[model samples]
Target: MALSSTQTDHLRRVDAIGDPPARPTLVPAERYHSPAFAQLEVERMWPRVWQVACTVDHVAEPGDYFEYRCGPYSVLIVHGDDGVLRAFQNACRHRGNALCTGAGSSLRELKCGYHGWTWDLAGALKRIPNRKGFGTVHMSEFPLAPVQVDTWERLVFVNLDTSAMPLADYLEAVPTDIAWCGLGDFRCYATMTIAVDANWKTIADGYSETYHVQTLHPELHRCMDDVYAPQMIWGHTGKSESLYGVPSPRLSGALSDEEVWDAYVYTQGPLMGVAEGTPFPRDQQGAGQSVADVIAAQIKQFAAGRGVDIDWATTDQVMRLHQYNVFPNMTFLASADHLTVMTSLPGPDPDRGELVMTLMTRMPAQAPRTRPADVHMSAADAHPGVVMSQDIAVLTGLQRGMHQPGFTHLVLSSEERRIINMHRNLERYLDLPEAERISEAAAGG
Candidate 1:
């Protein structure tokens, strides 16, 4: 099932031209409800792509390890004793049982709890618990399987496909774009994954565009460009994003553009993270500058206090904390001096999933990095951040509403090009032939 029957037919029809069906709007509801579609994604899409497994800080020391699970696949990302990062199938060599159920640290070697079969950090079998008990076991051929892995801007990613393209090529300009915002310098501060009663795409799509901000996250207009920027959108490593810090031209209700600008410049404090008591320069417009310019001046002052220098005048404030949606599941929200990294994994069914949200920023070099927080989910009032809570709060209802017979297709907006981009990319992976998927991924197709 595709976003719509037309979405499905159109894809098959125009695919000969090397372009995807233009799913600008009216996506089929089956995209979120079809079990076959979900299975296709799991079998065809998830395995052959580059996915963020964890942050460098998560496995900062040799022996520190974490498990990355997607569907039936489990990968153990280890900081090898060689002082390099490596990923391996988490199953034991003997009897193919999981070597480790969860994350742990300071393990000199991987010892299977099932039978105590052991392997070294180099993924070489070191011992079998019962030496004489395994006459048929071939130790030479039984080492943990390795997966393709790499790092960028402290993010560790893994690809199940051996032939997949190098991480740098697939990622293209994402790092460069983040570096431009100075977010490449930020470090992970706090991270958490929340289970949501919606499809992973539903949650990811919510963050990709600002089409719903005025109706969904009205408060965000205080400092966000709810409208998508066309020119810069394509420059984001071939991804789509919604910029922050600049007011949305599509104001909620009937507010004037001047009022939006006034709110953008004048609204201070936690709402926009302005210095606690920073006052607005003027009530109307600040010194005859555009919204982005006015925001830069105020933020530059605020950032100066924190010892970070930004190109105040020219820095596109919209990207100060923009949300960049990488294909598959990762969405990196690079804000001024920090980022909110988000990714998702499917649940028992694809319609439900776990969404991990990490609030990351630079801690002074001397500060110890904090571990990720436990899983949590709550309504707008209870979730830590009201903005985020609101997004999560509507998911359950949204998921159910998506299945309503009357709501058979999605009505997207111009600002929602990101969702379209993601879907098309997803279809590319799904439609790929099994034999070619791995090879094409390796080629960064």
Candidate 2:
């Protein structure tokens, strides 16, 4: 017999509470300075989560390999002789030295630099410098430790737990959402790495909102439509984000003289357009109109040739940036034309963190694509790694400020609540009894 409507509603409500809709602010100290908390997080929260390591393009050939970190653990991604992608603990069994220090082409065996103990791509022990030194020793028992590895949409991920849930199960709605954004068809364009003196959460918190756009990036802010607000997505393993809409000045037909001036200023400012002479002044009449009005004007003018009345400023097309924070340490941001993945891992110092950004594009078949010589900046300059460096500075400063004797709690904006929800999920996962925490599926139907 089928269940009644009331029963369905009850089940839905129960699920919502299990993954609560609202949560309290995460105390600054809990995240920024606590070693005990960080360790517990690694053991409980990170091990069960899905983390992005690298792209399939990095190791496309049979022998290609890449190395990445899952929280504090270093993992090696290898394409074995059997033509399978595998992930293993990068540490060697003999003297605890890292097996692979960097990324490169395929290797038949990964040999330890410290002691020369060797293991194949499949992580099976193949060679020992002196087998007879240890009498009656079993080589099979010394194979490298394996980690749970999987791929989706050509991205690689590793989980420390041997029996962790499948990547799809943990990802929940992210795959379908990414498909909606047309990310599968998009390729990487550039990549950069920034080492920062702050907690990983600090870097993530900065990306979660558009509130900083107006002040933090005054020059770039002119091109952005500020009227539309951001929309948040709830109820998944971690924090998932989607923008409802953004202002598009080019689509809006109401651009005033002042709006045009702002656009010219933005275009001329070190990045986009570069033409000589002072920019035109804002039209006095256009100065009073909303930013949306000016954007509408520009969009109409630009679209008239294409035969469309669409106002990109008021339209949803402007809301193209989609970001997914895949619990604990990775954030994936995508737009119609570009994609960037940021991985945040804990550093040796409690007050510092390391971030690696991998930017990619569709692999072209023959002719190599190169940045235009006339362009003032490289791809990295276009999408300045300095922006992340700025964030790192702020996060580290915030980390230090949290320890002040006068500081006690935090005041959070509605938009900043996502960080709070992230902490709550961490707590829920960490607090679960060992048996109950095994797998979401095991919690029962």
Candidate 3:
């Protein structure tokens, strides 16, 4: 396929992470504003893509289940009595009624309350509840229809199009890239999910680049580089990533001592909540110590207290500083001690969408953790300001203005090459006919 102007810039970007090609095209705003366009995504894009449906912990035990809700399609994942994990169309095989209502466990069969049809966790039909009432029936033909389900490092993913590429093939370069982070052991530390009034892609795009950080999150500059240049914004195959930490290359010289500690105390200190959010001990050497030297000492001492050995010098980049956009709607940011997952899913309204944020960490092997109940945050609810509120305000504002006469498209930078690559990859899915997509996926794309 011939590259679009935007994609050609993306090809140029692949040569180096820090520089944006001189002339990336302006992205059309209609992609974010048009309901018809959103509907095309609903029909041609989302269904054909593989997405993280839920975490493995959501359905960890036999009979446990979680609803992978996207738009009006409610998918149910269950750890069945057969000791296997499975995904199925949440609708009953009979009369098209929903089979699962919400998430719960300890079930041997998924029984439809409406008409009493039931299926096993492996999606096998088990009962029709007085089969004579339906007269002669072919029970095999009435079993729950299955969705393609697979896992990678404990993330459960589902695809509605059975003909799309295998999950591993779809993941492309992501797995090996994140291997050093040891993500599998990072338990769910905290999770927050909310429905919102913005397009899912808009929210995904918000996290795709660091260009807006210096303007939107200046406080973070104290500890991490928000500068777009000199930041390694590498992309390969179908995935992309960028890192934080390492003082901004734009800084003329090494950070002053005060700059190091001030940045540390405000950012990493507060984040670690060292001594319950008070200033860290300052016990480490205070005079003439480089940032790396100070950080290396602190990590060694901290890990010593926790009875673990971490190669901080070698794996320092993993020290709470890397992130990746997992195509479609999932973004994962990992620190040495934790991982944050952000997801954007189509909303009930074409112009609006849903957002989910989950914090995964291993700060303490036995930290007290709880997954919070899903809540609906109003558009006006910018309670915990800064990052969340600023992003919400801007995206909602963009949503409102995108359709206006003055605004026609997005003027993106090389910093947002990830977005360009993402949209083009989406086009691949959108262009294929549904039957062909399924066939291609099943044949191992």
Best candidate according to TM-score: 3
Better of 2 and 3 by lDDT: 3
lDDT of each: 0.67, 0.58, 0.65
Relative to the true structure, candidate 2 reaches a TM of 0.71
lDDT of 1 by residue, 1-445 (tens): 0122322222232111123334435566777878888899888888899998888877888998989888788999998899988899888876788877667789799888887888889899888877887667777788889999898877889999989989888887777765656554667755676877889888888877665767877766755654443313442234444444445545433554445445544433442355433454456344445444455555665555666555443445433445666778888766565567888778788668878876676444565666554455533234556577778888899899988889867766545667766766776878945432211112222
For candidate 2, the per-residue lDDT at 286 reads 52
On TM-score, the stronger of 1 and 3 is: 3
Question: Which stretches of candidate 3 lie above 4 Å from their native place?
Answer: 1-22, 228-247, 251-255, 267-270, 275-283, 286-289, 292-315, 318-320, 363-376, 379-386, 432-445
Against the true structure, what is every candidate's RMSD?
A: 9.3, 10.5, 8.4
- Give the higher-lDDT candidate: 1 or 3: 1
- Candidate 2 ranges with C-alpha deviation above 4 Å: 1-28, 70-72, 225-227, 234-319, 362-393, 432-445
Error of 1 at 379 (Å): 5.8
Deviation from native of the Cα of residue 215 in model 2, angstroms? 3.5
TM-score of 3: 0.83
Q: What is the TM-score of each candidate against the true structure?
A: 0.80, 0.71, 0.83
